[model samples]
Target chain A: MIEFTIWDILRNLLLAARWTVVLSLVSFLGGGIVGALLLFLRIGGNRLSTAFTKYYVEFFQGTPLLMQLFLAFFGLGLFGINVPAWLAAGIALILWTAAFLTEIWRGSVESVVRGQWEASASLGMGYVQQMRYVILPQALTVAIPPTVGFSVQVVKGTALTSIIGFVELSKAGTVVTNATFQPFTVYGLVALIYFALCWPLSKSSQILERKLNVAHRNH
Target chain B: MSLIEITDVRKSFGQTEVLKGIDLDVKPGEVIAVIGKSGSGKSTLLRCINGLETIDGGSISVAGAQLLPDEAHLKALRLKVGMIFQQFNLFPHLTAGGNVILSQTVVKKTPKREAEAMARKMLERVGLAEKFDAYPDELSGGQQQRVAIARALAMQPIALLCDEVTSALDPELVAEVLAVVRELAAEGMTLLMVTHEMKFARDVCSRVVFMHQGRVHEIGRPEEVFARPKTPELRQFLGVQ
Candidate 1:
């Protein structure tokens, strides 16, 4: 059997970590755009569209991310669409992240008082104009903290993509363990790398919450 | 011709009917005060005229434009009638000037420079010219309400609806808001106020309406209503104060 040095394992995991970071960003940003669209449909749509968006959010939120990745990975093959592992993982994570982001944002929008709606509407502003000028600006400030906080969940969620054979940080740890026979050191280092990626996001969420709330302290 | 015409208007919230069939006409430049105890639906009537609340039956027409549930018509009607709330309801994120400038630019499509100029003038009219750059949270309740007035006035609406505009202010701050409303009445601006300030209403309003159990219990000149008080409900209402 060939011997593996600590540096060899570390280098491989680091290379895999890059994919984790990339997948996290892609899913987060893609989810944000999709979530915003869903928010408009839920907020501004007729009863039919509102109900459609509600169930869409609920279905994704209710399901396991691992199962979704599996469905996107193997389920598409049944329909003659053989998506690559990376594409399947990205699609699954984005859909899952969007479900959470939509609910978080909806809560932020609803927290704006009913008086704000009446006050803006009475100014001769239409619904779209009211949302653009009055509601969204205020809601956005409230949305930032939870949105950033949710990004941590998105980062951690990237680990599940490893199950789909995309070979991110967690999957790389397993591959390194099989060759090096050092499960404890490999998994511990993998956990540390995740903490490094996620800690700043968690801290920044608190910082943003404090900073944004300052504008409304007296309000 | 009357500036606002309400014919057998009705409104309900769930199983509870808030406005039992009511009718009233407000002529140009007339200042009418609607007063009653809580749950009397005085505020509901003002909200209906502004299209903030939908009427269950009958009709309301402002400046010959019917206040309909359709978005285009509601927007058209709102352009003609401005409303002030009891909560002041200034956009907390916007400055006093920004609050006043928003509708002017968005709804009226006034150029930015012209909207700013008009915002300043409206703020000056409400005695808040110095507070143009101040945010709503930074202003006192009285100042905030004045900014709300400025915001409404900048829209150049034909009539103003005040839903207990001074109710949220501290007792000492009430006079400043009333002073602004009093000035508006003096300048021939049509005003429909659901108010509790009896003396100010008597002095400034052209007519007084007493609402009870979601119906107009009595209506007449403030002097006639306060002095004669035809209904016992009105008599009892005026008696408590």
Candidate 2:
């Protein structure tokens, strides 16, 4: 029998939790950059670019993200491009996040009234100018709550990266459990760590969404 | 010379022909009100004048700038012609002052300070001087419309085209917005409006255009048109037949 103390297991799990935090950030920020470009293309871009973005979004979202990670891990090696688990996980998660986010943001942009576009045009604003001055700012307010809410899913999705051998919270739990032979204790702490990361995000998203709506209520 | 000229203008949405070969001329300082039934293309005609809707046929030229397919040319015309809507359409994200200041600074290239100064002055003109910092959603319907008017006037346009500007207001609040329009008319701003409020048109408009079946069925002095409509369409529109 192994003599692995609870303190040692907690400390190791905490170290692995750092990777989860970093992975979530890299994917979220990278997805945001890619998603914003997709948003512009989906909304106001040319016909060809618009179609291109549509297919791109559908491709990632329609498929399972775990399968995509598997391809990033094993599929790339078939072509002799050997990448690390972090690199494979990073790329897969970003693409998956971008696809979902582009659709989310496009819905927000379209929700702005037709009159806003007309009023802006009547004042001599060009397409980009209207977006910069009126449309995007208004859409951003509508987008914030759902976007923050989506972040919770993003954090949870990072757990899937561990299947491709990325040593995040879940993988760390398994390792600590194998060493300590204490499944309930080790897994309980893992769940607590994830809850600590995710709870405030979901709670604040609801609060801010309510606050924004109340602020816009008619006098 | 006319400030705005439309010759044989046509517009259609798919199978429906909204404006069929309409011609109109608006001279400087002329206050013209276009009145008609719901589907008679009055709104479409106003939209065409501002380049909000592209004309299917004929020419629209305002202030020496023609409404061609040319983007630069149309934008020039838009700058010269201010428009207000029935819905007010004030930018919700900005304060009342910011709404007025945006086009001034962005479109007209006025410096930020000067634009803010002009916005405050225009808000004062609309009798909303104290609400510079209030957002549109915070204001009442009449107040929001007034902010929209201030936004348009901030552009110092050659003429204004208002599309049922008070149609969305409550009867009580309608008076407040109409007062602002009346003051603009008194100032001799070339005003073209699409309205159902016959009394406001009669009092403020120099000439009235009664539209029916996508054409200007009648045009004359407001008194003559309202009192003695020559065409059956105008008579029916005035409800005197």
lDDT of 2 by residue, A31-115 (tens): 9999998998888889999999999998898888899999899999999999899999999999889988899999999999999
**DockQ values of all predictions:** 0.83, 0.63
Tens-place lDDT per residue, model 1, B113-232, is: 999999999999998889999998999999999999999999999999999999889999999999999999999999999999999989999999999999998999999998898888
Mind giving the per-residue lDDT tens digits that candidate 1 earns over A1-219? 988887888899999999999999999999999999999899988999899889999899888899999999999999999899999999999989888999999999999999999999999999889999999999999999999999999999999988879999999999999989999989989999999999999999999999999999864
Chain A TM-score vs. truth, each candidate? 0.97, 0.96
Candidate 2 iRMSD in angstroms: 2.1
Compared with the true structure, what per-residue lDDT tens digits does model 2 show for residues B1-241?
9999999999999989999899999999999999999999999999998888988999998988899766688789999999999989999889999999998888889999999999999999999999999989889899999999999999999999999999899989999999999999999999999999999999999999989989888999999999988988777767786
Give me the runs in candidate 1 sitting further than 4 Å from their true place.
none
Best by lDDT: 1
Q: List the residue pairs that clash in candidate 2.
A: none
TM-score of predicted model 1?
Answer: 0.98
